[model samples]
Every structure is written in structure tokens, then in C-alpha cells.
Target chain A: MGRLKSRQAGKKFLAVTGLFAMGVMLLLPIFVALPALAGGAPAAGGPPPDVVAAQEAEGVEGEEVKVEIGRDVYYKTEGPAVGAPAPKTADTEEFYPRYNFESRVLLWVANQQHLYYGSFVLAVPIFCMCIEFAGLVSKDKAMAKKYDQLAYDFVKISLTAYSLTAILGGILIFTFLTLYPAFFGYLSSIFRPVMHIYALMFVAESGTLYIYYYGWDKMKDGLLKWLHCSMSVVLNVIGTVLMFLANSWIGFMMSPAGVDEQGRYLGNIWHVIHTALWNPLNVHRILGNMAFGGGVVAAYAAYRFLSAKNDEERAHFDWMGYIAMSLGVAFLIPLPFAGYWLMREVYAYRQQMGITLMGGLLAWLFIIQATMIGILFLTTNYYLWQALGRMTGGERFQRYIKYFVFILVVGLLVFITPHTIVMTPAELKAMGGQQHPVLGNYGVMSAKNGGINAIIMTTIASFIWYQRGNRVPAVKWAKFGNIFLITFFVVAHLNNIWVACYGYFIPANVRIGLSVPQVAGTLSCLFFGSALNLAMLSKSRELGPIRWGQIAPRSQYALIMLATAFTWMMGLMGYIRSSVRLFWHVNEIMRDNSPWAYTHTIGFGANVISFNVLFFWITILFVFWLGALGAKKAPVPATQPVPGAAPQPATGH
Target chain B: MQTALYLIISIVISVAYFQFIDWALMDMQGLDYFYILR
Candidate 1:
């Protein structure tokens, strides 16, 4: 009994010691990291006993940069006389950074560039599908041949863009190494293996891309076509892998797992990469990129249309815009869900950060995001309405547009209001609170749920409008489809509104979960309505001839503007999501520079991002116009997919 | 239908597994990149 007791006591003691050691490792960093990240100095009267001892033993550089009583050390930097920042010495209020802003921003920009470059390269192959479809459907030999050439152009453009992307990647790497040698050292050490994998993936991607683009002609036939399509899939796969690898780094940065709390290097890199938030961020980012890419491509199409000299160009541009819009909106429908999932994970990782994102620091950005989403929906509706005039049965659908306009606009305004204003004490006394009374509810999940669903519902309304005017259905179940369309949306709306209402009263977690069902309902209607409409139109005919080049070109530019808006909004939303950890570099553990970390006003953020979008659009438009300028117009075949003459009216099936 | 259901279940499980592994790898290396020392 005595021996047994001793053995058990020894085991208990070992377990207790292990727990204490682990606790120390975790808790010590929580105390150490905060002041370091905040750039806060030791108290002014005298250095802490510990700090004094450390200062006494300081290295030569440390001794030279002794802390003054009041002023920040960062104020004495040895940079340019005109452009220099304060010195980053012991006296500075600024934290001893692992890195500087330029280095930080470069890495940030590099990561973004990397994601987008891969996205564009991957998207090129996906766009190839339309060309393949055109090749299959075009009855006239001449038309089929034009489509083949178009496919050739698509691949050609991707090849050039791919090269630019590579150059950008190289530039990013060099910038990282040159700007923050110290920070780069710390980063490169941890991510050495990931960087190796990324390098290999890029090489593989380059080779595959070249082969895919060059081999198009060689593999033009049935088996070759299959091969070509397969190559596109491979390209996307590799691109996705690259994105995932990169996401691991970003995700880990936000929620570094597998390490003891002091930010020490852990043995298993995989543990770091697959931090809890990694998967959701990957999902959200990938979807956002696809939607953004679609918008960009669509805008390009619109730009082409606005510049076209004749009807054929207009017709082509119109079709391209419609398809691009469709693709963009299609990906966009599920985007909010992914975003929601990301936010959910953020809350799960740390609730304080999530609260700051929604209720405190970054809430204004969310309001702006709400406004952008509203614009996206509104523009989408207007474009669809314009496109409807070209279709056979399109006129009847025009009447319903007014109702949708009202619902979407009302929902949008309510969605974008700031929940909490920066009120003076006097203002607070008048208002009776920090949070606004009636307006505060609009910033809640209930209002956003309603707003997004309303937006979605409106987009579907536009799609239905467009579908109605474009073609007359030939399906045996045409009557059933009409009924289905009506019922599906009606039921979907009822369900969504029900949840939105109930969400207001429920506990927060339950209210949040309710959104899943609501979103799923909208998706059901969106897909069901779309598929039903497509099936109905497959064998249908045009009620009227499409007079493409007749419309004002400025109207078409609106599509490009919408696309640009989409990109900027996505970037903004991404930043907001990232900045949720209000003052933390990493949530809770690493405090950020609190003053700069607060969100700038919505107006300012929007103007700057719009500038980014505008800059890109102008440059890309120039590229697009340049590409089109060299084009020689080939004669279009008389018959499109339809059986009859110019208008292809095959109405009475 | 049963086979399809089983296959879907298996696929979901596998995907979750892979996603977890991939995410964890990213976390360790990525945190440093973001300057999250703690």
C-alpha cells in the first residue's frame, strides 16, 4: 500500500509540474507581449527594476538610445531630413517592432498580389468553357472558326498576364528582403518549407500554363479538346493549392496554433498553417476572388461594347456583359455565407475582437460594406433591365422593376447606417445613450440579414425580368416552371423575413445560426429559379432582333464601374475582417498601435479604394482598347443558335 | 442512394481532415509573417 501510494503521488506530482510549466509558457507571453506590441514605454519616473537592470546590461546601440522621461524614441530616427520618422530607440513610446510599416505593407500587398495573380490565371481556363460551348453550338463553319480564334485570344491574354504575375511575384520577394531584413529573417525562418513549396508550385504552374496555351491548336479535336479542358482543371488545381499554402501563413498569423504563447517556433509547420481560422478565410477569400475576377472580366466586355463602331460589336459585347454579370452574381450569392462563416470563426477564436469589429472600432467599415453591396445589387438590376429590351417577351417584365427598386433601395439605406456615432457628452445626454435608438437595430444582424436577402431577392427579380424578355419557353413543363418560380421566391422570401424578424428577439448565438437556414433558402430559390429559367430558354426563340450597337456607350461603362465597385468592396470587406482584432496584432496576445488601428471614416476609405479600382480600370481599359484596336472584323454568320432567319423566331413549337 | 450517402459522408469526413491539416500548417508559419510574436 505504501509503495503504491508513493508511485501514485509521483505520477500526480509529474502531472502537476507539467501543467504548471505549460501554464507559465502560455501566461508569461500574455504579459510580455502586450506592452511590446502597444509601443508603450516603461513608466516615466524611473525604469522598472527589471528594465533598469536590462538597460544597464544593454548593448552599445541600446546604450546610445536611452529612454527619455516623456518623449517617444521613434521621434529621433536617422532617416531623410524631410521624410524621416522619429528615432526607434529605447526612449520611444513606439514598441520595438519585429518590423516596420513599409515592410508590413509590402508583405500585405505581396500576399494580395499573389492571390489575385493566381486567381486571374486560373480564371482564364474557366473562361475557356464559354469558348468551347460556342465551338460546339455554332452551326456555321465561319462562326465556329471565329469562336476558335476567340479561345485563342483568351489563352493568349492569360499567357501575357501570367508573365506579369510572375514579375510581380519576384518584385514582392525582393521588396521583402530589402525593406525589413530582420522581419524577413524571422518570417523566412518559420515559413522556409512553405516558401519552397510555393516556389515549386509557381514553376509547375508556369510550365503547365505555357503548355496549356501553346497546345490549344495542337489539341483542337475531340480528344484534344478534352485534354485542353483537363489542363484548365489542372491549372485551377495548382492555383488553389498555391492559395491554400499562402492562406496557411495568413491564418496562422492571425491565430498561431501549435506554438507556446511567446511566439516561439513550433516543430510541426502544419500545425501553424492549419490554425483554426485558416479554412474559413480560405473559403471566403477564394469565393471573393472568383466573384471579383468575374466582375473585372465583365467590365472589360462592357468597355468593348461602349467603344464598338457597329451592331455586331454591340451584340457581342452585350452577350459578354450578360454572361460576365451572371457569373459574377452567381459566385456573389454564396459569398455572404462564406463571409459569415469567417466572422463566426473570428468570434470563436476571440469574442472581444468580434465585438470590436461589429459594435466598436470597425463597425463603420461594415456600414460602408453594406452600402457597396447595395450598389452592386442596384447596378446589377439596372443592367438586367437594359438587357431585357433586346429579348422577345421582355416588355411585359418591365412593369415589375419598380417594386424591386423600392424594396432593394429601402433595404440598402437601412443596412448602411452607423450603429454608434462618436457622440460628445452633450450629444449623448440628448440621445440618452451611446448607441443610437432606432438606427442601432439597422446595424445588427437582423437588418443585414434582411438587407442581403432583399438584395439577393432583387437580383433574382432582375434575372427573371431578363429571362422573360429574352426568350419564350419551349419546355413541356413551362407552365409548371412559372408556378415553381413564383412559389419558390415567395416561400424563400417568407422564410428569410421570418428568420430576420425572429433573429431580433433571440439570443445572439441562436440568432446567428438562424442565418444559415435563411441563406440556404435564398440559394435554393436562386439556383432553382435560374436552372428552371435556363431549361425553359434552351429551345426558345427571340421575339425581336437584337439591335446591339444602338445603346449609349456610357451605359455600358456602368458595368465596368460596377465591377470595379465589386473589387473595391471585396478588398474593403477583407480589410475590415482582418482588422477586427481592434488593437491586437494577433487577437488578445499582441497589442497593435491603437491610435492608427481605429478605422478611418467610410467616406475616406471608399475614396481611396475607389482610386485603386479606378486606377486599375483605366489602365486595364487602355489595354483592352489597345487589344481591340488592332482587331479586324470578320463577317458574322447569319444564323445564331436559332433555326430561322435574322431574328431567329421559332416561337410556335 | 445508400452508396451515394455513404460516399458523401466519407468525402465530408476526409475533406474536414485535410482542411484541418492544411490549416494547422499555415498557422505556425503564417503567424510570424503577420508579426504576431506572441
Candidate 2:
């Protein structure tokens, strides 16, 4: 045990725990900060003349500490001796205890609403696509009708969830008004038209979701299906717009513009809308939310599937799980890039803030972020493996599992390692600087090579020959394709190794910048290979029929796990991004000081993240269950007695 | 011609925006000496 504690295992455990602690610490700060920053500041009833004069009198006549810059006194200059009290100007102490209570509630509501909307927008639509595709390709009419009914049922579930989303949004607005009335008033003044636009969009989205859901039965015919699906497209557009409109408020708060230094209102609202990091965040949030939503819905499907009565039910759920996992991972693939873009914007807006997020004092939060991401990838890979058994030719490919596991573990360890350590002076000396030279390289490109290489492999594995589920490749070019793939992976691995090793020697800014092309290269390999494989398999033969309805209950849980991981990771990363500014309320406008400034441990952060995720899923599940309970069960799909008679696996059902 | 025109426009706009931001930040930092970065 002692030896284990002293070895690499101990190091990894410590690193992982450190990652979680960082999340708690970083997230706690915002809960403490918003109230402090936005609260107080210019209370009613102007200061007594004597109070102002007492501030001016003390000792020196010319030493006026109150330096007014336009309408707002940005700061109070240093005055008198150390023992002398701070020269409290008009609303110097900025104390509004009454407002703070409500503001706190408002902030929590906003955060929750953000999460809810994030999950709702993504989960519902993806479920529709999944069940729709499922129904569309079913072999027998009864089976096809069942799929259609299930797809219809899925949209019905989303319709109810959408209502919940609206209710939550309403609560958020009410909380905002009750808590920070004046601040809300000021923000509202700036966002009057934007809010109107958002309201209109909400109406549009609600109409679209309602019409689409209610019209499902009426629109079951051929051309009607296309029209019905288009409503989904419309709903997504409106949802995206709603997110963007809401972002204007946060973007303005963080990167406030449209006003001069004095807080005077500027006429142009667009200046207020596109606050520095706003657009990137909009993109990031939309994608992240969808991925998160996908996770919740997937988890719901998993939970439901696990409790199914018969083999047919299990089979149906197994497919649902696979569909959910695919949708979640698809969105997830672009998340890191979106995050990178957001970080770049953060740096562009304020370099110090970016450093604080990635490499400075608040860097621990990002360590937590790395850990979450690692878990997300790990869960996704696990789900894929579990899903393999559900596919036809799945058994034969089991031998490749060990290789996938190896690459994944190596990648995760590398991804989560700290760039530099806060060690004792003695420890630092032994390691040569604050970073471990040898161990550090593992954290660099070699590890990324392991990670991305593993992911690419998994993506390749995901493209299982649906035709025979267990059928081996038989095309004449199959050998050549395999050779080409091996060569591609080898070159990709070496390319990462070359870059990562070379990165350490470069300047810090440039070194970090190199991640761009490195990521690009990995993605190129991933997408190109997947596309090529699909093309190759297009004309391939199938030896057996797919056994869709005969899946393991535990396999369904894998999809749920995969999706939940994405949601949790999104929230963790979002928190990290927001916290990078540290004590700054709005770049330079307000400073923050609260007890929640310290980083909480990884265990604590993960628990809370899990709590939020569980809360979302459980509520969503209840909604799904309730909807299913009230609605008439669609007709059961009747297929031929011999399942997998002819492989019908084409696209996701 | 269109590409050249767009390029010219973009370059001019970028340069102007960059300079404006630099000037604003410099002015704010120099005058009050608030630790905006921190």
C-alpha cells in the first residue's frame, strides 16, 4: 500500500483530486462575487453635507482624495496616514444588504435556467432525429409504424420539456427583478429591445414546438413528415436566437460597452450586444448545451431501457441508447475547439484573465476541467465497447479492445497533468524548475497523441459494419485500406510527438498557440478516415441480419453515462471560463472580495456537478415517464420471426 | 477586384479598431492606474 501510494498511482490520484478541488473553488467564487459586485453602489438620499465635509477636512486642505472621473468616481485616491479611515465618497461602501439576498437568488436562477435551456434545446431535437430515423427505416410496416409512433412520442416528450424550459425562464426573470431591482432596471434599460426580440423568439419556438408535437399524428403522411421535421429546424433556430439574446446581458456585464468610463448610456445597442467574448460564447454555449442536453436525454433513455420488461423493449432501448450516444458525441467532438476559441477571445479581451484561467492562480479550475474532459472521453469509449456486443459482428472485434483501452488511459493521464506544480523548493530543485521535465513531456504531445489517436480509433470502431454486425471485411481493397489506416495513424502519432516535444522549448504564448494546428491535424485524420471508411463500406455485402431488439440492459446505461459526462463536462468548463477573471466583476468596473475566492477540491466540484446533472436527468425522466404514462402506447413493431434475416442497418434508427 | 476590395476594407478596419482599443486601454491604465489586468 505504501509503495502504491508513493508510485505513479498516487501521483495520478492526487492529480485527479486536485482537479476536482479546483472546480469547487472556482465555482464558489461566482456564487460569492456577483452579489458583492453588483450590489450597493449609490444608495438613495444624497450624503449629508457634514459627511462630505468630514471626508475633506481631516488634516491637509489640498489633499482631496475624491477624484471624480465624469459622473462616476472610479476610485478613491490614497489619503492621510495608514491609521486613517478610507475616504468614503458618495456610496463608497456600496452597501445594499436588502438587494443582496434577492440578487443571490437571481444569480442562482440564471445559472439553473442556463443549464436547463442548455439541456432542453439539444436533448429534444436529437431524440426526434433518433426516433424519426428509427421509424423511417424499419423493415415491416408494423415495425415502421412503431418507430414512427416512438418518434412522435419523443417529440411529445420534448413539447412538455419545452414548457418546463419556458417556466424556468419566467422564474429567472422574476428572480432578476426581485433581487436586483435597480441593477435589473439599468440592465433592462440597455436590453429593452433585445428582451422583446427574445420574447418574440420564445413565442416562435413555443409555437413551433407545439405545432410540431400536436401535428405529429396529422402529419404522418409522406410529404407531411418533411414539413414536420422542418418545424424542428425552426425550433432550433429560435432556440439559438434566444440563447444569443440572453448572452447579450452576460456579455455586456462581463465586457460592458455602449457606455463611456462614467457609466453614461451610449446610444448604440449593438456595442452593448457584441461585448468582446460574446459571439464565441454564443457558439460555445449552443454546442455545449446541445451536447449536455443530449447527455440528459441519453441518460433518460438508458434508465428507461434498463427497466424494460422484455427482449423487444430492451432491444428498442438499446438502439435508443446508441442513438443518444452518437448525438451526444457528435456535438462533443466540436466542444473543445469552441472552448479554445472562447479562450482565445478571453485572451484577446484581457490577457491576464486568460492566463488566470489557463496558467495562473485560477489554473487549478482548468485542471478540474481537464479531468472532466478526460472522464467524458473515457465514458464515451466505454459506451462504444459496451455497444459493440449489441451489433451483429461485434464479438470478433473484441480483441481490439485492449489496444483502445491502452491508448485511452495514456491519453487521459496526459490530458489532466498540470503544466507546472506548486511544490516545495526542494521538490522544485529536484524536478528542474517547477515542471517535471520527463513527466511533463507525457502531459504534452505524446499524451495528446495517445488521446486523439485513441479517439480516432474509437470513431473508426463506431463505424462497425452494421451489415453483419460480426461480419469481417471482404472487399478487395480491405487490406490496402487497413494498411493505409495504419500508416495514417503512425504518421499522425509521430507528427504529434514531433510538435509536443518541440513545443516545450518555445515561448509560452507560442507554445500554447501550437495547439491550434495540432488539433486541426487530429480532426483532419479523424473526419477524413471516417468518411473514407463509410465510402468504402457503401457497396459492401452483408452476411446476416441485424439483431436490434436483443441488447443488454447495462449497454443502455453506457449511453446514459456517456451523455451525462458531456453535460457535466460542459458545466465544469463553463464555470472555469467564467471564473478566469478572478475578482473582476466586469473587467475594470467592479472588484470582488468574498469568502468563496478559494478553489474547492475536485471531489466537491464533481459531486455538485453530478448533483446538477442528476437533478436535470431525474426531472427530465419524470417528464418523459409522465408523458409516456398519459399518452397511448404506440402499436408494437411486428417483425419476421427470424431477426437479422437481412441486415437493415443503414443509418441510426 | 472584389477580393482585393474586401481585403483592403478589412485591413483598414482592423488597424483602426486595434489602434483605438490600444489608445483607450492606455489612457485608462495611465490616468487612473487601476490594475485592470489583475
Q: How does the DockQ of candidate 1 come out? A: 0.02
Fnat per candidate, as a fraction, reads 0.00, 0.00
Each prediction's TM-score against the native? Answer: 0.73, 0.73
Candidate 1 residue lDDT tens string, A263-342: 44434455556787889988887777767777877787777777677666667666566656676676777788888888
Model 1 scores what on Cα lDDT? 0.62
lDDT of each: 0.62, 0.59
Cand. 1: chain B TM-score: 0.64
lDDT for each residue of candidate 1 in B1-38, tens digit (9 for 90 to 100): 75455455545543443334323433533322112232
